[model samples]
Target: MSRQTNKLTATAVKSAKPTDKPVKMADGGGLYLEVRASGGKYWRMKYRFAGKEKLLAIGTYPEISLADARKAREKAKERLSEGVDPSMAKQLERKLGQQVAANTFQLVAQEWLERVHQHDVVPDHYQRNRRRLERDAFPVLGKRPLSEISAAELLACLRRIEDRGHVETAHRVKALCGQVFRYGISTGRAERDPTPDLRGALRPHRSQHFAALTEPSAVAELLRAIDGYGGQPVTIAALQIAPMVFTRPGELRQARWSDIDLDNALWSFTASKTDQPLLVPLPSQAVAILRDLYGLTGRSEYVFPGARSHKRPMSNVAIKAALDRMGFKGQMTAHGFRAMARTILAERLGYPPEYIEQQLAHAVRDSNGRAYNRTQFLEQRREMLQRWADYLDELRQAHPSSSQSSAQ
Candidate 1:
């Protein structure tokens, strides 16, 4: 039973002041008033449970008064009588309170993003996931608790995005939502992943290949249009190199000078999609472009730094906007350069499929079942890339404005 004697008074608690050392006064039962040298007051209870001593924090004084502390002591005594350790009970309460606060879908999803980033997942993947959450998931389910969210509600949120003609985005959102739910479950904020129930619920997503102009005449016209682009010299250089190399726009924009070896005439970096190191054999034309850009942006890290600041790479919108200016708005994507090069190099240039695939960094396997390593066909790739650049020059020369390429 809790000791009924009371030794602390409201007036004494008000008069307590900081000292050189902490002072703790007993109030009876196991409750006491602790005064710190920093002038902080805390209420605590000490008790024995199952042959072990434990401490339970009642609260701060003034917030929890002399009378309330006794009531709390009595409550703890009752718990101890029922074979429950007061300290363990208090810890459980705290954990439950934290779980309650973090139960919301938004909170759980943010936590999931932090874990993804901690494991070195790509920043673009995180940003895209965040965007989908804000657009489709957050408005409807952000504030709702993960345990309380039904599969139907999540499906509705995804269906809304699908209804707007973004089936792929909708499916991606569902997968991410599942990831967040699983994260929450591991953290004790959710019960089960609701995404399993959503299989076949969303409309089937058909992947669309990037529209590209593969014909020699079309590529020539596109080259002429890019050459006449009224933009910064940096953008013109990026546009010129886009067709000359089989690299994704993201890789090109984020290109670092440290990753380029002008002496070796090679650009090497780890590709984000495959998480594999790739060596891009720089052709003479590409090397010339980089050398000229060196004079302008050599000090900066990014080859195509943004116009306003050199700290960041140029925005993907810059490329899209330039393509729009060239009147190939929807007809070409920044990724279309890959398809264009693939088709032309294979069909027109008469390069071997293996050589082209290796240069493109596709996940092709060799006869020995080993994955194509970065330097698998280095010398052959070096020859093929230079040939590809020369072929592009040949195609450009067929245009009426070809002489301007020589003059410029």
Candidate 2:
């Protein structure tokens, strides 16, 4: 019932057309050469398996000769006899290839970010994590497969950051790698996390504290030096308010005009360190200085707009430079104002530590065991700020010679 012919040659296959039709290969048993309208020749096998006729492609002509095509066709027949579908087997191969590709670190990291975003990771947290990936991890192992990442490679990546004097950042990078690796493991893309062995690997860092002027006389000298500052009005006002308010240099420099209320005598700003909105009750002197600066820079949004760029605020270094110019480089920094206020307000003025702490916006436990509010110690803070300002003025007027002569 089968039409058998002599072995098909390349010329015969090329000259054949759909009209000429296909001929069964004498060597192939049931396999035949198919000639199409496009003059393309293909080898196909026709067989009965499980009471059904099935056709399977061996390969094209020339590339796979008649003999080789028949050999492939015979192998497929053997698989079919075992109840295996060749089409499904090919599909499984393709799926395995895709799985291998998706197991790459770059692919897994992208998938991790997608999953994290869907779970509502806060924007700040997302930004921080993304920065770590871009700065610390991506350059080395981004394109590598997750399973290819060994413990040595991970330790090397973290050590690069450690070499830059950021032990804390190196530790954080190790943590992020662990997170990404765990994500890979959960998705069956990676077999093991490489960061667990990195504990105690980094060198210890020396602890350093900010230099602060704590003595009242030294603080008074620093204030007098700031008062005599011949800098720009914004810089001078920032220096003036730095000791009075004792806020962090960053918070003071980034203060916006909209955050200040001259009429209510309040300087309200979102504290950068705590990420909380704070209401600082301005004393009469602080209010007067703000009024003068407001009239000068009221049109701009920032209280201390940069000289070169109005859109940006003054730099924190500018305040420190002002202190350096006054020859107090090592003795006081812009942050020293907080120490000055804490010392003078608590010891010299005999103000309640709670009231002074609240004024400083330092974290404190309330009477109800709850956190302090933005308006905590409102009345007491108002009184304390005024008293602190008056005390500074009293110190400014008191002279050593006059006080000694009066005592005599």
Candidate 3:
């Protein structure tokens, strides 16, 4: 401790030179000022708490006047005497100040993604939310703090998405922002969310359904045309089996060589659409196609390997394009094969509805009914597939001067 220089006035304080003895100024209470040996003066407060003495620096001399320094030091001492650790108290105050400064919409949005979005959301919702955030929210409010984001700024972002003819997407983005803001509020990062004000700001969007073929005869004609496609062998095989099996285009295209057992007449595949392992019993015609395809593609992993990249499966558009080449563009789609099979197997073939649904890999209501394993009707399906193949053969036989005849 140094001697106090309470006698020094403001003028004397300015003139004070470097000395061993420090000049002291009273800042009220136990706080005092000391002029250092280097002529720079600083505020120092001394207090005893919890059986230990603690020294705290309030501020530098004229930069923080004696009066203010003394007041600050006294406040700290008062807190210390009240069973509070002033050092811990100061650290908490600093942390709170930093949080307040960082409490922007952007910060809260990121926090929401890191905390809630990644864990609580389903895989599809997680991916959709991430895409929405990247395409809409990040471009505008990503760098802006949550507290600084006004309703006008948020509206501008939503309007931008709406202008691109994505009104529904814009509405979803706004709703997601509201969720992020609420998360921020719960986590003590924001006081209020501004996204609620944008409810009616965006234009409503009209819903559109996918165009699909549903008629039985039309579907049969489409299948006949696909069977006559004289494109690549892999394309022909895919088109031939796609209708017969009626699986999703992805599942059909991504069929692997290892999953098929020709001797057992089974086509096992991990279905991407259902996320379940499926076992499809191969019909005699399907087995013949696979046997031919195996001789060509068995060396690789994929049943239909891409021409440009053997490691990857053939493109989804390949089958549809082959169908187009066969002149059945609008009359059929890749998915139309499902309608064809469902209608024919249920109506013309007179197969049970449950068997048809099970073969289609559709979820059935009756669990107590015979298991829906596609292989259950293996023998019947083989017969049915051969009959369908024979029908297609007859169609080609009838069209003597067909485009496929020239190609073949």
Q: Judged by lDDT, which candidate is best?
A: 1
- Listed in order, each prediction's TM-score against the native is 0.73, 0.65, 0.58
Each model's lDDT comes to 0.86, 0.76, 0.71
User: For residues 1-408, what per-residue lDDT tens digits would candidate 2 score against the true structure?
Assistant: 775533666566656656555444434456788766565777887776677877777778778876677677667767788888765665787898888787877678768877863344433456677788888888888878898899898889888999888987888778878888999999889999988877677776565567888765565566677778898888898888777778877778878888888899888876554556678998999988888888888888888888787787887589889899998989888887888888878776788888887777677777788868788888788888888887776654556334322222
RMSD in angstroms, all models? 6.5, 7.1, 8.1
Error of 2 at 316 (Å): 2.8
Better of 1 and 2 by TM-score: 1
How do the residues 1-408 of candidate 1 rate in per-residue lDDT, one tens digit apiece? 755668888888889887999999888888899999988899998888888887899999889988888899999999989999988898899997787767899988887787664355455656777888887898999988889999999998998899998889998889889889998888888889989998899889999888788777778888879989889999999999988886888888889999999989999987766778889999999998899999999999899999999988988778777888889988887889999999988877788888888877788788888889899888998998898888888777775555434322
User: Model 3: per-residue lDDT, tens digit, 99-170?
Assistant: 766776666777788778866643445667888998799889887777677899999998899899888898
The best candidate in terms of TM-score: 1
TM-score of 3: 0.58
Give the count of colliding residue pairs in each prediction: 0, 0, 5
